[model samples]
Target: MLTTILNLLEVAAWSGIAALGFGILFNIPKSVIFTVFMLGFTAGLIKFSLMYFNVHIVLATFIAVFFVGIICMPVAHKIHHPPVVFCIPPTIPMIPGYFAYETVLSVMNFIFMEDDQAKRVELIDTIFTNGFTMIFILISIAAGISLPMLLLRKDSVKKIEE
Candidate 1:
């Protein structure tokens, strides 16, 4: 659908900006900024598309990151930098900040609030749900993003000529 694609594009743009900030933090060189932006944009688009299709968020993240990793391989080969330089930057935007933040808030509330039996149980439930989801999603994204290195027949980085 045109509307879906347009929405995806908007998500990609915002995600690209986030990834660009991470790229700067990661010391990614200026020359590859576009590539890095595209990486995040594409990853976010893929993830969004899968989610739109009613895919599980964790599964969508894995698929998206795996796709990004595959795409990064050739780009890294062409640019002569390590694949991680390209791969990790894009995945930055995929980090589930909302879930992570909620997990933290849940823990803080559980710890700081005076113990009422009903409230304590409720807080624990929230913490477990958000915390586990946050941890697993992060792991899923990292694993998916890095799997290419393990699975690819070619080396991820070129050997420097001495």
Candidate 2:
């Protein structure tokens, strides 16, 4: 129990730092830095917690990004900046870097290896698996982030036009 809590905290802290760094890189307003950190922390916590309970990574990421999008809407309204500013930085931490890296590595290996049928088949399997997983995770993140904005567009547009 204690270990799980500590792990969650560690993930949260690191994710917050990553998000803050991206926010700085993006040149977001100084006042919004803390909010970005909190958003990142929340995203990490939600994603990690779901994964800890044995949820699939793709679904976990989608849920986490969706919640972040939902949460950022109100924060954006209060801060008077677009919700995307908050929504994007937090999601940087959730990107499946390992899967992407492995996909690329597998592809390179597949291309360079000699004509060993069994070895080639194995490499092809690895390439497809990792590549598909990475692609789905990215798709989910996009859907999760955009769904909230699309759903709330009417109200957001009305407010902006006023």
Candidate 3:
């Protein structure tokens, strides 16, 4: 129970930091929820494989997804005209930095190991896991954010036509 509580606290702190950083980077001032959601997503990405704390993963993911939805609101406003035109600010905070780092470290280990084939193989496997996981996360997050907006826009258009 104590460990779970600590992890929740950690997730909150990290999420806040991430959201603030992203908001500042993108010049979006006074975005409290944005900061929280971005940070929460990062936390979810980090704890994806933890078997003991699956609940945290779900909560963090929903929180992050909610913020991502909020962020997309303004994006939808800007790209309201040309559906193909999408504007992404620099500090969106969707990229998973830790996963990238892990991937790089794994690859480096594989390359630097002189004689341990097993270690190299293990590192290689981890590298693939990290890379694919990041890719999957990115695709899923994008889709998760985009799909709703797209559906709404389409429905609005249809309503107008009708």
Top-scoring candidate (lDDT): 2
Candidate 2 residue spans exceeding 4 A from truth = 153-162
Q: What lDDT tens digits, residue by residue, belong to model 3 across residues 23-111?
A: 45655434333534544444444443242445443333434544454454554453343222121322134466788899988887777
Tens-place lDDT digits, model 1, residues 50-128? 9999998999999989998777766776887777777788888888899989988989988987489898999889999
Could you tell me the TM-score of candidate 3? 0.59
Clashes of 1: 0
Model 1 scores a C-alpha lDDT of 0.84
Worst 10 residues of 3 by lDDT: 82-91
TM-score, per-candidate, Cα-based: 0.88, 0.91, 0.59
Which residue pairs in candidate 2 collide? none
Considering summed lDDT, which 10 consecutive residues are worst modelled in model 1?
A: 153-162
Q: Which prediction has more favorable TM-score, 1 or 3?
A: 1
